[model samples]
Target: MGAFGRMRNSLSFTPPDLQEARLEPVRRRIVFYIPGYDPEARTRYRLLFVREWTRYTKRFGGGRREISRAELSQDGLVQSWTVSAPEQGDGAETRYDVLLWDDIVARDFARSRFLSVALLIVGTLQTILSGLLFRFYRLSWKYGNVILYPFVMVILLAALSVAIAALVHAHLGDWFGHSLGLPLWVSLPLGVIAGLVWIKAIEAFLNRVFFWQLLNDWVFNWQHGQGRRPDYERRLDAFAEHILSSVAARDEAGHSTDEVMIVGHSSGGLTAAEVAARVLARDTSIGTSGANLSLATLGSGLPLVAMQPAAARLRGEIARLVTDRRIVWCDFHAPQDWMNFPGFNPLHDLKLRLCGQPVANPLVRSARFRDLLCPETYRRVRFRPFRMHFQFLLANERPGAYDFFAMTLGPRRLREQVLAPDAYSEPEPAVPL
Candidate 1:
């Protein structure tokens, strides 16, 4: 009993110096921006930072917890790390630009992964509980035409769903254990039955609040002086409009842009591409004058919409815009990822079916392709095969991906050297993800 208790105590977060355990992978990569280290501006290079740390963890919480601290530091810097782990424990970590772009890339990536899991887990549970309470409701024959009340039920279900999510979230410390949320299949019918008011309430309070706050802050601060394709796309036209409107008053300042990039990941990738296309279509509204643009898409599922001819045509329009804008499109897709299905010729679309019977996931059936795009522009651009969708912004895994992103994705000044001198100067070499 004492031994077990003592083991639990040692797990608290603590700094590197005070650690009783061995120091983390003593090896460190000095991740900073190329021209110089600007913690705020370097969010795009965050991949390089994350690429360096995925394999390591160190004890951090000062008490008796074993939480690992992902650190950030540099020249004349103190021992500081930005822990992007959210209130709900998720695998995603966020990259922030503490001193350079790499930090931003790392922290944001972590955050994204964290949210993805939360969405799946929380969303599933919320859907299930809602399904049980509402879908399986025993409509009493007693209170016919009584006060119509979805509000009370919505709140009750929302509260219960949140409670369940919170409970499951608490147990994340126990990895390698069964997940605390509802098992698969339960979420679909359950979530569908949950109703809009309840779903939105849960989404707003639990996920949206956390996601939007952090992401919005990063966008407003890090996106200035960035170019098309070179920078990560995190905003919608309305977001861009706000920024443009704010800056419209300031001399419409001129800033030299070496490169411009727009990056999208998973669903975000789709949103990013749409935003970039709109911005490109209306560059005058968002430009800081004299800025170039490049387009980089990671884990793209442009093919998902191909199942519907109308949607396929819409994506084709976006594709054409990418090419027409003369912005190079490097579409990355991975086969192993369950996040996106249909792992082949992107042009061909597949309808989601159940046991060979057509079933509909409205969201997918909606904007994913045709739901959010223009058909004319979607047809023109080509999606080259990229197998590793999960590692879209990964810095070191695939040289082609790394090069396309780090070197070619941004404008002249904003870009970094992705490949080693040997790859650029040398002959053909086998590229792997």
Candidate 2:
């Protein structure tokens, strides 16, 4: 059988094997980090994490904690690292693995400009014809603007280019025709050349401002929503298999893991959900394996694709995950981040139905950037949309409930952090012994 066939067969359903849960401080935790559509994430994420974690240590006072060097997997699909912080609550050791898929993103970004613009036009037309554009606006006006920003900019840039070309053509045409006694043909081609030159001139600026990136992002959403991106599904399968292997692998003395957490940021939110669903479907016994499985989606852009009618696969996966009691899911969103959907309920708002009793698997909470950052810092970054969106992953200015480092490296398990009514206040910096 083919690789896809083998994957399908391996995911055949298994019988349920539910068992009692043992919840405690996380000692040996394994984390799978799924990033969004950013092409630079492969190297950028590690550096970003290290920089933010250092900032985190300084702010929260766990200076003694140290992160080990990263080790890449055989297939180069994952970059794994270990973070040991023995001074925290009861001492914790966490292994973090970043699921790599930035290669695909790079390819998308490197495609021909004609193809990119064509895809953008197609995606925009689909959004408009399918009525998703209006629906998106009704759901989140900010998101609606995000969807339209690229198209609008493209149009404005084209208009500006045309205006410049026309002005140049008039001056050149006057010189060539009236003064030099030349034909209109000379000025016409020069006008076209002038327009092309203008577009070429501003290409770097547009890229720096993320114009093409956002266009490609929307195109990805459009293609993936229509089930055209099998590459992403295959990547998710690999991610699921890795998670299952991690769960099944025994330590030196045959000890099971304490917790297995999958963190999905931005568009990766739905990707992480699909991974957990596949794991559960393949082996129902995972729930009884004595390891806590938790899904944490930060600044999740779930609705961007899940709202599409053709995304039945994603919707089904989300449904299965939501009804499952074994895995704990928490979604964090901030009002300041226009890129994410805040206060969204998958079951209620998205209308996903459950087979059995209602399950509130995803405990939705506000990241509350206003509370997480100091007034001065918040004011500086609040207007910056991408900065606010990334705040979910960055270290907090103050000790708040949504500290990424605290939830991942601190002693507390994700479930504990999610269930606690009070904020996760970090301890004072440990004095050197």
Question: What is the C-alpha lDDT profile of model 2 across 258-301, one tens digit per residue?
Answer: 88889999888777888889988998887655777888998887
TM-score of each: 0.33, 0.89
| C-alpha lDDT of residue 84 in model 1 | 34
By TM-score, how accurate is candidate 2?
0.89
- Count of backbone collisions within predicted model 2: 0
For every candidate structure, what is the RMSD over all alpha carbons to the true structure, in angstroms? 22.4, 8.1
Residue 5 of candidate 2: its Cα lDDT? Answer: 18
- Per-residue lDDT of 1-433 in model 1, one digit per residue for the tens? 4321121111111111210112111111111112111233333334444443341112111111122343444432222233233343222121221222334344544465335334334433442454321211122111110111222333465577666554444443233366545544554344444443354566666433233333322232222212222333332454333323323332254422223344455444444455555655665433233233334444443332232233443454454443342333334433233233322222222332224322111111001232112344223321311223334443332223233222321112211122122323321223321
RMSD of 1: 22.4
CA-RMSD of model 2: 8.1
What lDDT would each prediction earn against the true structure? 0.32, 0.78
